[model samples]
Target chain A: MTVELLDRKLLFVTGKGGVGKTTIAASLALLAAQQGRRTLVGEVDAKGNLADFFEVGPTAFKEREVSRNLWAMSMSTEDSLKEYLSLQLKIPLVARLGPLARTFDFVANAAPGVKEILTIGKFVWEVREHHYDLVVVDASATGHIIGQLAAPQSIQELVQVGLVRDQTDWMLDILGDPTRTGAVIVAAPEEMPVNETLELVTRLRDETVVDLAAVVANRVLPELFTRREEKIFERLPAAALAQAIGGPVQPLLDGAQLAVTLRRTRGVHLARLRRELPPEVPLLYVPYLFQRSHGARATHQVAEHLQEELT
Target chain B: MAAKKNPAANTRSIEQLVAAKEIVIHCGSGGVGKTTTAAAVAAMAAVHHGGKVLVLTVDPARRLANALGLEAFGNSETQVPPAAFVKAGVEPRGELWVAMLDTKQSWDDLVTRHAPDRKTRESILANPLYQNITGRFVQSHDYIAMERLHEIHAAGTYDLIVVDTPPTRNAIDFLEAPERMADFFSSRLLRWLTVPSRSRVFSLASRPFYSVADRVLGSKFLEDIAEFFLLFQSMYDGFVERATAVNRTLEDKRTTFVVVSTLEAAPVHEAEFFIAALEQRGLHLGAVVLNKVLPSSFLEKGTTASARAMVSGAESLAGAVPASVGSPELVARVLREVGESFLNFQVVAKREADTRADLSTVPEVVATVPYFDRDITDLAGLLELGEQLWR
Candidate 1:
């Protein structure tokens, strides 16, 4: 029951900036791949780190294999529109023509969310074509990506007929289907990110047809010591701990205190998060990695944790 | 003695720009604490330097709006409660103002000011294409955000204005939006697009493209777009004028652009990209503020070596049978964790420094602000961050 994300054909991973949203998206893709699903991880924005994280060269508009059973792409709205127009207008290079491009460009510039629609439409095509078992989108942060998700519906209202309306309807149908498509909101165990995540959930629930799947609580600090040990450690000030802990171990005790303080903050926030979010929206707490690097190993560790948790 | 270096080599902090420049625009990758840095700089200039400061944040979340103690700001500037400063125990010699860019309202204001009459404004505002662009479009906020800043700057109402460039998702495209805007407004193609169907004058001249677009997209979209442009026909020069003026303000000596970033590899890369983009656009990059950067001085080489030695010694000492001591294992474990934390902080610091080192090609002073344990929620918190910023 918990491995619901893997059952879906399309999964959108989004949250606030710097909250390890990309890490979670990568992990989810890995988890899908491990479950024997041929997965494609797509980054909607131009600024992407999929290549770096996978220790591969940069990905572009075209999908490239980053790992076993997994492929990655960083989609550009421009390239998407170019491909779209070339296909739709039946012209070899419709996007190259200044006048025809202007007609296509009008939607990008003057229409709200058309650029987003283009990007999503490309994914919709991949999903429709059944090229991959799952397509995971590393969308822009919560604030902007919400509008991107909603663009299909609004475009449906704007374009009343022809191939454009049919395409918009196709995207909307896929997005609205709970079993086919859903999105997870990733958050950090802190005030601002949590606040934004909560706001995003409510707004998304209200505005879009996509199901609010779950919340990925990234970088959650684990309680290292027992309750009794933590109390004894917590009561001692850094200086006192240095002496009481003894044996010239003052520096270590002081460092342990810092770690405790950080976890204490996380503990407080994590509790508040549980109390606030509805029980239906499952909370998946990714272990907080204390190390500095956010490389391939860290990403896969979280992926493994995700797999283990769902199991 | 080791070779002497210039003391003022890196003396150009962002705080100095607050005092020196009339306008300070903070540009950065998303989640690099750009809005907080902008607010911190504004509060410092308002309270410490006693300059009249206004902060215009493009944050859609209104995080800065909340931090500045405003419920929320609108297109028009709202003076931050001087009481907010007083509550923080700081008296300001000059006033502080804050605003959030409302794209639709600001665009309406632009039309209201430049449009010839009420009828034209109403039609343009009501047009579906215009409605979409003004309301929910992505990069539309960029040029409009700067336009309002230009409008406010021209009024000479404040000594310094701090702008947090909106995370419009496509920041580079947004930054270039005004040019896209100017091109659209000034283009003969748009003028052709604007031709009223009631007149047959240019209908024959532009039949090839016009008829094709009308046939392809249907009369409704073309009609709405053409009518929207027709209304803007009178106001096109005004739009172009404002764009040029804004670009001039951007290029002016009194205006400074500050690039903000966190220590993370992704953000650092984007910050470098931003700096290069600014340079490519003929805009001089003034200062780079690496925000949320880990403190490197905490564990210098000497401290690191000694801490490692101390931890290893403790492991050996704790390995010896405890003489009925309450928990020698606890001491060893604590020592290891402490050593680990120090080593962790060292790695974090080096990563942060490497990010800043990437900015070396651009000759700008790096202002490094330490990562905090909690969010800067209010003016008091912001003031504390300001101390860290200027420190």
Candidate 2:
């Protein structure tokens, strides 16, 4: 299915925790940058794994150049507050004064939506600043991302103030516009992530009017065994297999069985993914990279795969 | 000032313990009001009782930021909005502080602080393995977070400290962080690895081929270790000593460990494991905050119409139990059904809570926030959340 992902200013990637959303989001950003488009990859959680993937230690909340056309950052609420305070209040660290700064940190860290709103606010700022051709948000898990995206509207009803209200309104306008923002759900080709992704798609459809551009089925198992190869494994004498299990032949059998088990699991998950996903939403499947996705090399490989899909 | 009494407070007894500077932990399943409840309790202590409070959270979902009404938080302390507190009629007596655990940064800070000297710090920072281990390993991060908690407590900046522990799933890591760090420091293998000259001399004599193979791998491999040891040399003694102190502090009765759980099965199971883990570590379980508990009214309704329809739809289609029941409504119904079946989950949670000697009561259902149809974001949402929690 050759579906061209729409040209979007923002691509929001979210999935269940541990579903490779960050890796895929980085890949998408890298792919855009490789295509000669200036790109920024932002991680909402303060983990800053993006820098690690880029082979750097850690990027601050402020965007730092990673490559020729790529930049990365991990959003920090304290830094954002400092920026907000400095920009809005025109007070240099006075807001962080005795007792006041501590109190603010406590409240900011504890408040629900404050992190999401700030993270999103930062993304909106980056988008408006036009510093990058593409701004990719490595959002929290699917359920939380939905909550995070809904934050602006939720806060707008409450604050109704000067800057906070205006910021909320501006974010809402950007997120609500399909042309401006595109949300992609990333999932492993496993039961839990795929099931959660379907639920996420349904929830997004129900709650917000934003466009869910595609579903990226990550870590999909490629079909390596034929039906005849499966028959041969089945026909292997049980006694011989059990007796020789400690030898080289046993290891090969074990590998074959693992491949078969993985294939079966992948088949079931793929079928469900196809059935559950909205027909209109394009499904992009990324093969599982056998190598650990830690440094720049693996990220670049994943980006190569994403280039075709994004285009 | 006399303790301002309020019967309407969700957990008056719990609040009393919290106000007394007891270690109150707010934990639960994700999406529940665990973070918010923790923040409110800390706020209550700081604002009402004239007690300085520090709140520590490891919720990567950034729920604490939402609860505190801040745009974002870092490892550093930031201020809370005073207007909301004053408007809510809560007095500002003592101070409230917050820090989001940045595990890597904290670990680096610890390394820098504990390292014997500048050379040792530089060596440790230069080691690739050390960087990879600290930066990427989840366990390493959790251990550093715990180390930071101990440091903050020892600093004596706050009269009361409220720890919003990581979710129950990762609760074990947070609870055992000190011990893990201690074990890592004391590991025999690490000790052997640090003595490169001795290792190289011994390897060359005992296994010449292996030593030659090691040299072939890379000269930098040994250099990395030498640099690491040098950088970390100054702080080795201090790090081990501090780890011992932190371990002792954790084992003390004054250090309260609060287990947070939801009424749901997954969180309940997680809470059970957490309690067991804490007991094994010789830490006291102070209180269990059961968050997002469904009101008896909702549970009594048996199943929602949608859930009933799903069951019927399965029955009609398969004429038997379907291969899988995978709908949100079904998941909810199943959770409810599980809650009703053995009641074993809550029974075990309550039993565990009761067995804790330091705590005055078993698990108490403090505040039960109903599921709001809308998403919770911003300061107003958090204040609304505070109202729900305090109500």
Candidate 3:
């Protein structure tokens, strides 16, 4: 496989929950690291499955080496907030203590843009921190990734002074540039996720004005059946075969029918997605890996699959 | 007790229901306009009712920010645009505040506040295990958010606080914040484990090997426990005190839980769960806001003409149309099927409504905001949402 998109410095992978987003992210990071680029994979969601994937204990804001040339960290909003307060406010223990800290936490958690701002702020910092050559964020699914990315802009307007505002402004500039920051949407070839992917792209284009680099249609079925199999099924003796197969065959037939139905439905959604997506944006199809895509082995498989499109 | 029928019997406007409280919780599933409704209520309280209002949301998605005509909101209470309120014709009598929940920061603040000393704070923060455990505990975030809400209320900055709880995935965690706080405090396991090796328990080890084991495992264990307790101690005390006060406040009808939902089965089911959970805890179920409701009028007027026009137009334009024949009818039928499914969901919602006598009413089904055919990336979209929700 030709690795076309592999040289990119940043890869932002996101999809609906439970759609193997983490697996794909881990693989991409692994691929980058394996190719000898200093790589770091980050997750903003509360579920820190990356540590488990790397066979390490849970990680925090501090980057821990997971593999050669690859490091991992789970962004903690509280830790980031504390770091921000200490570094920005320069108020030692008091920054975290007293009414002001509580008020800050409350406001941060209660506001729509604050959490995203903090999470993305951390990413922007990592990008500029010069710790690694590439940074990959396992962003929340399509529904929220746009908002999360745009959070810095929302927050930059409120705080005019200091590093927070400066970082926000800088991050916005980086994110606004297509070459600097790339968003790759991961989706299963299903109606909801595809529709959501399309909607998300349209929104990102409209709202953030950032172009999406690619659409990764994950868990696509391989064309397993051919014309011969179709003909065989069609030519089977109707009554005798039905009787020979009996009740067990009924469920198998039902299962086959369901599979066909699902495949056809998925095909239609995929078609719609292709029709909606701008032609320039590369659409990468990753076939369904039958086994659970956990740990290094599964991730490597995904990496191999992603190698051509990524490069 | 009036002889005449109650206009509000079948349906009540959200304005009447939210008129009384300083806080209204819009709780529901994703895509149900819970965020939009929460913003509108906060806007209503600030502009119409003449009260300083704050809308707190935990939706990681900035949909709420988009709906409020704000470029973005942060962990601090940012003021809503005056233009938004004026455009909505909502007379601004008091300031409008908006914030999103950052549970981690709140949790950390709780820890730092309660730590016995600066040394203890440093030790707890430094420990890796403490960091891992605290991060994994989802309720910790909710407890901190609740604490923040109490602080906001105590500060008297805003008269009303409209909170949009995290989506239904962890609705229980948000509601059970107090209980979780109490549990964290009362649990002695961490305290027992963290006690220093110099203490009586580790002194029992006499041999050099045992002493080494004691030094390594015992100190590590104690540090872990100490770190855990140290981080949580202040939060525990504060949470208990605040929870007691807040529980009483809620029980006395000072706080209101507005259960927001859609006329859809899953959302309605989630609303029912919220109601049951609230009632079980003795908290008042203030109001139910059924959002994104397809107005019954749209269903009755079938698009027969539109369907026919599309079919004829498709035939005239192309020799062979793609996919199955009657594609327009199929699409319409699918939409109608979705509508029927929603109607069935309303049946379930109505059933739940009947079972509960405590403040159950349906607001007119707000139409689904058209996807704008464009991405909602800025404040304009949020303001557009504000208009739809308020109306």
Candidate 4:
């Protein structure tokens, strides 16, 4: 289905590692908050580098407002479990349950779906409670996202009957609804990321009830030359260029050629990604930024690009 | 070749490290070319060191298989044919073998090897929790990877084994996986969880924990978990001993870790963290291979000035060239585009230099692989990258 991504209450931003998944997530959250939506962006893994994107100090399980309407937090499974116990289970004495929780944490780690359910359950609960207009999760990379998205269902099947089993019904209701929840896969215009994006597209559809909202192709390189201009670039006389530039021009031209080749190579993969992805899933492109720094400035730059794309 | 600017900083080359170490574990955050780097280094060792070399990759793209000239290699090791090396125009001094970790297969193999009896083996194989652990647990991937490495090392087959770690949420997850696996098997929690259901429900000290767990998870599900762990408890000694052995293999003096990362902000931070992790654990950090580094050409003395000239004086400079090249307007545009591209890349290149300078925990060897215009999809290309690391 065609999706207006931000209209969805929940979005899980994920991709293969190092493809700017967190950047895309930060940008989407920033853009949503800029549009006056109360938004929460969470980093599922505890890399704790999410704050770098906003130039904010370290965030915690307690959501901190990084902007007017934007709040950021890092998911800690233990904290999530503690909250679940206190808030949902109505277990008042969290201090007394420390050993119980610690013991449960071991089971959650080794058990297949327990940790995933706790992590995704927190975000799903946020959406269900209307705590935020939108929640964007910087979810696990391509490898583990399926396990995470399908956690509630897996839990339902595994646990015959219990509080956790009953809990999955509502979480699944929110997660399974296309209007309320969708996944945004961020990919670079490279062979592996594109290949992974395509693979994940199929997996997300088959394995989980979450809808594929869109794919963000991040760091797309610019085309350096037009057909005619490329010919002109190729035919430029080496001797004249060297003399005119007052230095050897071979390395400079070679560098440009390298850029051209890199872009062209990435173009083929990008085309495959576009052609293969379901046409309804809008593909957003963000240009490769050669910016010197990569903190809040880069976040704003990405947000601007995303704003242009979303429009 | 770019002049070596920091020779004194590199006390030992990657080549020397590989020669001295029997096992080289290539690890870093994902998408930093860790798999390709491991393959390339193994290829180089097979060519130069003249003994059997094996590359154990957890998950490789199809193109990596093509790069090694193998249709596919799975749990069983497959030698990269001599013909494939010849096709890449190299005569290797030794054999290069490739294997991809099949987690499910490895888990089953571990079960078969460690299971106490035929009934226990069959029961564990049939256990639903066993299926879930093998199929979905992310830590299983990490533990199996290290376990496989230990198994292979113990086999005494290859002169050199280069393994690429699984991509984990945390960079050091696999480093701790073996110990964690052992701890999980021996932890009080497992004993408590696996305690007889009647006793668990009746015990005073555990009453509150059971009541909470029973309500939260339901008694039936807890029973299933209890039964699964009870089954697993039979193999506890085997698993713990094997995990301890794997940990020993990692800490072995003959084993060294080569952390690979691009100079991107996140990856470099992870690399730094991973290096510190290695140091803290007293694990050997043999070298750091920085992949996809921009060329130093952008940092040359006159290149920036030349690029600026091409941009600002494009029209006039186009006039200086032969008319046969193209219309002056097109030539000028081409010059501007090329010049602008150079400046753009120069910014990134400079950023890389600054990042490299700021890298505080670099080891005795720091190798940089320049950005390849194309993906490395063949043995020759792998060698091309290998040559840089070898230097």
Q: Which candidate is the best by DockQ?
A: 4
Q: Write the per-residue lDDT of candidate 1 for residues A60-148, one digit (tens) a residue.
A: 99899887889999988877876876677676655245565666566555445667788888887888889999999898787777778
Candidate 4, residue B195: lDDT: 83
Superposed Cα deviation of residue B74, candidate 1 (Å): 3.1
Q: Clashing residue pairs in candidate 4, if any?
A: none
Clashes of 3: 26
Best candidate per lDDT, number?
4
Off by over 4 Å in 1: A1-3, A86-104, A224-227, A230-255, A290-292, B1-9, B196-216, B302-332
lDDT of 1: 0.75
Q: Candidate 4's residue-wise lDDT over B365-388, tens digit each?
A: 789999988988889999999998
lDDT value, candidate 3, whole model: 0.60
Candidate 2 predicts chain B with a TM-score of 0.71
Off by over 4 Å in 3: A1-311, B1-11, B66-69, B83-91, B125-138, B195-222, B230-236, B249-252, B263-265, B295-298, B301-391
TM-score of chain B of each: 0.88, 0.71, 0.70, 0.96
Ten-residue stretch with the least lDDT total in model 1 chain B: B1-10
How would you encode candidate 4's per-residue C-alpha lDDT over A1-311 as one tens digit per residue? 45588999999999999999999999999999999999999999989889999999998999999989999999998888888888867757577775765667665865669899999999999999999999999999998899999988788778889888999999989999999999999999988999889999999999999999999999999999999889888887878898978986887888898999999999999999999999889999999999897888999999999999999
Relative to the true structure, candidate 3 reaches a TM of: 0.49
lDDT of 2 by residue, A1-311 (tens): 22245368888898865567778888888888877888888888655567767888788887888888888988777677557645654545443344444434332322234555676778877777787778898877664566668767655543434455557766777888777787899887665567678888887877665678789988775665355434433444434322322222222333335445656767887888988787878888787665422468878888877766555
Which stretches of model 4 miss by more than 4 angstroms? B1-11, B60-63, B204-207
- Tell me the tens digit of each residue's lDDT in model 3 across B1-391: 1222256543544555566667677676555566666776676567667767899887655556655677788778888888876666555787888998776666566667767789777776765545533443333456666677877787888778888776433356677766655654565433443355467355544533223323322334334445555555645565577777655555656687777665433355566777778777877666666554423322222233322332334233222222332344343333232223333333433443343332243222222332122233334444455455554
Worst 10 residues of 4 chain A by lDDT: A98-107
TM-score of chain B of 1: 0.88
Error of 1 at A58 (Å): 2.6
